[model samples]
Each structure stands twice: as C-alpha cells, then as structure tokens.
Target chain A: MSKKKITIAITGLNNTDNPGPGVPFIRAIRESDRFDATVIGLAYENLEPGIYMNGITDKTYLIPYPSSGSEQLLARIEQIHRKNPIDVLIPNFDAELFTFIKNESWLRERGIKTFLPEMESFMERSKDNLSSFGKKYDFKVPKSLPLTGAHQVDQLFEELDFPVFVKGKFYDAYKAWDKHEVNTLFHKISAKWGLPVMVQEFVEGTEVNVIALGDGKGNTIGAVPMRKTYITDKGKAWGGITIDDEKMLSLTYDIIRKTKWRGGMELEMIRTRDNEYYIIEINPRLPAWLYLAVAAGQNLPEAMVRLALDEKLEPFHAFKSGKMFIRYSYDLIGDISLFESITVKGEL
Target chain B: MRIKRSVAVSENGFVFDSSTGDSFNLNGIGREIVELMKNGLEQSDITQKIIERYEVEPAIFEQNLMDFQSMLRQFNLLEE
Candidate 1:
C-alpha cells in the first residue's frame, strides 16, 4: 500500500515574546489523522512560543527571516526543500507572506500548493486600497488619502479633516507622532517600513472583525464575525466576542468577490450608529480567532487542508450567526504588571 | 468546586446550560467527567476512572484533573 504523504511547513516562527497562533495551529495539525506535519521557523524568535515543550511536530527547522529579496527567499526555501521536500507550504506571518508571494511561482514549480491569492488581487485588497474598494462596493469608507510624507499629510489635514489615522500600508506600523511633531516621524517611518502611508479619517464606532475561509473558486466555506472586547497594549486582540450576523457575512463576501480572494481572509470593519459597516481594511490571511471559528463548528484549517489535498469538499454548515466568542489576552497569563494594569471598559 | 444547578449533560457528550440556554459539544473525556459529576462522584472516583482508562501518569493526571475541576468551578459548570 502506498503511504499517503504530506509535508507541512509553517514559516515565520518568530521566537519573540510576542504571542502567535502557530503553536496552536501546529498542535491542531499534528492531531489530525490526515497529514504528516513539520513546523519550521525563520528564526529562533519566530518559533512559536513553548514549541520546545509540545513535541507535536514530525520535525522543526530554523530559517532566518529573508532580508534581500524574492530571489534570496526562494533560494533559502529551496535549500530547505532539498533536505525535507515539503509538499505544502504555509507562511505564518504577514512579513513572510509579502516575501513568499514574490516566490510563489518558484515554489509552485516544485509541486507545493499554497493558499495565496493573486498578487494583483492582493494589492487591491490591502489597507491602502480599502477606501477605493469601499467606494466600488458601495460601502462607507472613511475619507482618506495615501501619505508619502509629513508635508503631504499636513496638506491632507489642512484641506480634508482632523483626527486622522496614520497607519502602515502593510501590517508594519508607521511611527505615530503628535500633530506638531508629525513630519519628522512620518519621514522616518516611510523610509523604514516602505509604503504608501495610510492617512484616513478616523471613524468612531464599534471595531469588528469578520474572518472567513473560501476556496479559490469562490465558495465561502465558513465565516465568524467578532468584536474585540479587549486589546493588548501591543495591539493584539486579547479578548473578543464572536458575533454572528448575516450582514457581516455578506459584506465580507462582497469584498472577497471583488478582490477575487481565496483562502482565509480577515476583514476589519467598523459599524456606525446607522447600522452600516464601514470598510476598515482587509487582512489577506487568517485572523487570530481562526481557532475559535473551529471551536464554533467551522473548522477552516481542516477545510483548507482537505481542499489542498484535492479531497472532495464536504458540505460545511454555517455556524450560528449570532454566536459570540471571547478570547482573553495570553499575556495575562504571564505578565503580572500588565495584568494588574489591565482595565475592562465595556461589556464583553 | 461544584457544577452549577443550571449545567446539564447528556450521555452523548452534549451539554446545555439552562441558565444561559446555550449548548456545547464536549469531548469523550469531558463527557465522562460531566456524567460522573452528575452521578455525584467525589474527586477521587473521577481521578481513578481517568487514571485507569488513560495513559497519563497518575501524579500529573491528578494535578491536571484538580486544575480542570477548579476551572469548571470558575465557569460555574460544576455543583459544589
């Protein structure tokens, strides 16, 4: 009997004290009877925290985060393949995906399957494109413009509006400064992070997230909508409530269709008093509570894994639309000072 | 720690909280523990059953069982 073989590689294992979903993902994958899995990281810091104790994977490799370009990253990944020969590659970090997308064709040539969407579609769905896509989809997006420098931003607020948001085009952060000190930091951040800086009209409303999984062919397998009840100082949603809403699902699907998106995508949205969900930004990868979606009866990772293996797609029952999921900050477990200082501002 | 009066467990791993009207799906071990709690088993009885059926070390299992019981108590899933 031919042994069913599948090699799973999880890249971007940051060994930092920062929390990650990779450890749990590794555990979940190892528990599955369907695949043989190995977890790999670009650095010791990138390795999921506490992975040394889990003993969950068939193997683990340490590869540093690629710095030069797509060519360098491709060569490094290819070197790993020469040793272990992965059949499927799952990039586990935002930065890693940016580099990996450029090498997608190279990896695909080796018969490795990935869940990445098209590069053009990816750029069209990013934070910089949020406002434009919102207009196209007939959704409310804050009035904003891309900031190339502080002078451009100064001109922006001078003509447009006040109390704006200055964020990175990618998941990286733009150095934020006071209104008086804006220009210097804007230049510093733009030069460091590399982006069309995001300057948007800050919308005051409920911050919500809608996470879903779709086959590249356009079928949305499952979705979970949530509101962050608590966020860590580091900007990670420490605690959130899973909310089920048909509107959230439809709005998410609308964006997904517009972008020709595939695989897992997390849409950040804000709901105004009039009950309209304004498009904030679309994260083109899995959300933090992806496991909660699994706990809520829509196992997206398992579904994606099945799809990658070319197994017949099973009928996925939609989760209870109004269900709520609450995830507490993992930092609360280890950081005493932060725990004592933490405050709960609203009903969870 | 105790199972709240509102928590209900079925023989097939289904759980319902009468207080919240919410239902949950528990794993086999979770089902067994919930059933044992319903049957009025003491901590020792539950531990004995778990130790005999699973490959976990007795000491570690006992510690984890106590911790799990404490957590369930905090969640109001048990009756004291």
Candidate 2:
C-alpha cells in the first residue's frame, strides 16, 4: 500500500520517572501503514530526551512553556510552521491542551489541522467541574472538594473522611489516611501544580482504564480497555495488559455518543466488588502507554491524523484482547554538541 | 458452567485467560479437571471420569475438584 507523507509536530517529550505521551505517540505514528510521518519534536527544555533520541524527530525546536503565555506559545508555533509546515499538531501535555484547543482556528488558517474537542467539552470535564459533569451526564464520580489554602484542611475530614485522595489540579494523586498526611500532600501538590488541591472520596476497588478516541459526530473511533499489571509510585502504569471488558467499552461509547467528543481521551475508572464503575477522571489526551493500544491493533494517532485531515473513517471495531505493554527506561549516549545545538540555537 | 471460551489451556499445566491477560499453572489433576470443564462435562461426569481412572474415592475427588474450581475462580480463570 502506498502511504501518504505527513509532517507532524508533537509536544510532551519529558520522558522521566513520569512519562509524556510524545515519544510513544511518535512511535505509534511511525508504525502507521496509512501514513509515513516526519516527526518534528517540540521541546520546552533543552534536555528533553525525545529531542536527542535518534530518528524519533526529524527536527527538534525548543518552544516556550505554556505558563509563559499562550500568545508566546502560538508565536513560536508560527515560526516553527514557517520552517517545517506541520500538517498536524498534537499537543500531549495536560497543561498545553488549552492553548492548542483555543487556537484551533489559527492552526487551520495556517493549514495545520487538529482534531480536538470543543472548548465546552474540554472545560466541563475538568477536575473542578467533574462532579457536575457526572451529575449531568449520569456517571458515577466521587465527591470532590477543591482547596486553595492549607486552612481548608480544618474542615476536610468533617465533609469527607479519612483515607481520601489528595490530587493535583493537573497531575499527581496520593491516598491521605489522616489529617497530617492530607496537609503534607496538600502542600506538596499545591507547591508544584499551584493552588486548588483537590480532595476526593476514595473508592475502594480495582482500577481499570479505557483509552478511546471519538469522532465529533458521537461515534467512537476506537477504544481499548486495560488493567494495570504494575503501577508506579506516581500512579503511572508501568506494565499493563489489554482486557475484554464489555461494560467498560459500553460506558466509553455512551460517554462519547453523549458528549460527541473529538480526538483522543482516556477514561479512568474504578470497579468495585459489586462491579459498579465509578468514573475517576477523564483525561483529554492519549496516555503515555498508548503504544499498548497501537500494539493491540488500534493506531489512534494514525486515525487522529486522518480525522484531522477531514478524511472519512469507519470506527474501529476490535483489538487484540491479551496484548500487553511494559514501560522501561534506558540510557541513550550523546555528545555535548547535540546538547549545545539545542541550548544555543533552540533547534536541533 | 464452563471454562471461558477465550481461555488457552495447554496439554501441560499452562492456563492463559485472553480476556484478562492473566495466566496460571495447574497441577496434573487440576489440568485434567479444566480439560473436562472445557469439554463441557458435568461435575458428576467429571468426578466419574476421575474416579474410574484414579484410586481415590468419589466423594474425596469431588471435594478436591470443588477446591480446585474455587482456585480457578480466585484467579478469574472460570466463567462467572
């Protein structure tokens, strides 16, 4: 089969203890039988590992972090577009998704396409608004309270109870058994992710996840359910295996059909002994372990690219149920010249 | 009522559940019982088949088979 050539720019290259989806997404795109990809790695820092990984990126450009401002981020992309002309741009970080989603028109004007959910869909599923999202959409979500300062801890236990979940607005979750632990976790999460630490009622159950993609027209492009075989301290899945879960898939389809979501997403849920599923979080992008989905025979990145190109597609129906993925770290040897290139020129 | 259709049972003791991506190893007797279950044999018939071949009493074999089946359920290898 003859494959079309496409140039794609992707962010989220900080593959450390906690990984980013960029490298794995790039790897998945590289395997697309439908498209040959020219990967342009977008980095926020000089030493992002994906920038130096051989053949991972055809070109690497250092971009300003989203915190610096969205206008600056767009300006940098405009510059990168002039040089490389991205056909599709996939922003992988949770922090950066708003910028890309807000500027969807600017990208389209420049001939860069992105299949992202509308701003309304994006905002409604945010952590602060998730409880209402569940109440409106009819899914089970644990009651959540947002904290701006440590003083709010005084009333936390009275509202909820001990052994609640301490979660960052963007990332990180830890189980706090008592008041002291909640305070410690609150300070830790707020210091890094900023104020508005979230305290969630802990659901006792086995954790299951569904990685899914949805078309804008209320159809699921693809969905794969998995149970983690191994997990990290940071609550990342280091090893996982695909499962044949009809209920998980059904719930995902219902959510997509109701929301009419676009692009990639993950439905994180906990299944209790009674077999009831509680929606934990709905992340707006593909997970770092997405290669597991690709290996299981759903190339979501490829499908997203096709969707972004406005190509008609039939929704994916099946994936290998028993496929598994294990995440590991390795050392890639490189010289100072490559590091100097990115540090000095902002491009490698 | 029967072993899961997606289960992969080997001639030896290996058992793999494709639905959950979990695998287990069975003892010789456990392997025979699983093979019988896969073949759609009833518990009484399975006990008869085992007792006819082995020296164990029917009641004893049935008790052990129940325990073995419980283990299968624990590992999520059996159909609910």
Top candidate on TM-score is: 2
TM-score of predicted structure 1, chain A:
0.83
Over the stretch A59-176, how does candidate 1's per-residue lDDT look in tens digits?
5554555656667667767787887787778776666676767777778898777777667767776777877777776777877678875667557766555556666656543324
Give per-residue lDDT, candidate 1, residue A59: 53
Which sections of candidate 2 miss by over 4 Å?
none
lDDT of 2 by residue, B1-80 (tens): 58988898898889877655577888898888899999999999999999989999988888988988887777667777
lDDT of each residue in A194-301, candidate 2, tens digit only: 868889999998788999999988999999999888999989999999988889999999999999998899999998867789998999999888999999989998
Candidate that scores best on DockQ: 2
**Docking model 2 quality class:** medium
TM-scores for every predicted model: 0.70, 0.96
